[model samples]
Target: MNGHSGNVFVLSAPSGTGKSTLAKRLVKDVPDLDFSISFTTRAPRAGETDGKDYFFVDDATFDRMIRTGGLVEWVEVYGHKYGTGKEWVSAHLAAGKDILLDIETQGARNVHGTLPDAVMIFLIPPSAEELSNRLRSRGRDPEAEIQVRLDYAKHELCEYPAYDYLVVNDTLDRAYRDLESIVLATRLRRERMGDTAQRILEGF
Candidate 1:
């Protein structure tokens, strides 16, 4: 709809659903797939870089961005702030590189509202029990937080109908194939490739 050369792909799922794992592999396997590293108020973990994994800003700076309308879409999760900077993503698209946004369901909705043409895909675990097990096995959060995530997962699943594509990650290999196919299909979309088509047709 925007006639821009690059596409915005929003991949969202509940915690512990293997979205990040698959996303890492997808970006490597697909050419020209750039990731929009989010800005976070939370402290960086071990070996995390400032501009790579996240912008790593403090709460005050994050609030200032929100107030100034610097972020394309920002959301607070588990008491921490996360956002995608408007200039960062817009510049990437202007340079003709697609960007993949790994965000939460609520953030995805906000992005969709702003960029109505953005493609959205929802990743789902094989089952709810499996999702719960994955979260518990991580042993990162306390029992109360884990339970809260599990409850949130159930609600997140309900938003599946909103996405353009539903990918059930039952196996890594199969899911990767599906993800690649989606990327390829989106890239080949006639609307996204009108210039290429005109060149080929006119033999210029």
Candidate 2:
């Protein structure tokens, strides 16, 4: 439907589900894929860069961007606001660059509404116990906060039906392969191959 414009790949998963790790790997391993760095109102963790990890901003700046219609999609997660910039995503996509959006389920749904053709993938843990173990292993949050995240994970899992693909991250290698296949398959879809199809037809 977007013709030759780039495709948007939206990846969403519950906290501690390895979504971020997979996204980083996908961009590193795949060709011509760009990761969309979102803006966040939360303080940066140690070793996190301002623009590389996220565009860390104050509440006022984030509110201003919201008022000026600069955000493509935004959501409040764990008391902090995170949003994707409208201009940046539009410019890169129009240049025919595939972009990966690592966002929450709500933001993914919002992006889907805005860009109907965007590919949405939901990552699932092998089991609830595994998810809880993963959260505890992080050692980043307090016990209570970790419980909150696990509770939220249950609700998030319910939204998997809405996603285009469900990737079970039981094993990292297998999950990465699945994610990679989805990216490749989307690029070969009929609508995205219009220009290539024309060139081939012309040769005949």
Give the per-residue lDDT of model 2 (tens digit) for 131-195: 99999999999999999999999989999988999999999999999999999999999888888
Best by TM-score: 2
lDDT of candidate 1 over 57-141, digit per residue (tens)? 9999999999999998999997899999999888888878888999899898899777788899999999988888889898888
For model 1, the stretches where C-alpha displacement exceeds 4 angstroms are: 1-4
Query: RMSDs, each prediction?
Result: 2.1, 1.6
Worst 10 residues of 1 by lDDT: 1-10
Model 2, 119: alpha-carbon shift in Å? 0.5
Candidate 1 has an lDDT of 0.89
lDDT of 2: 0.93
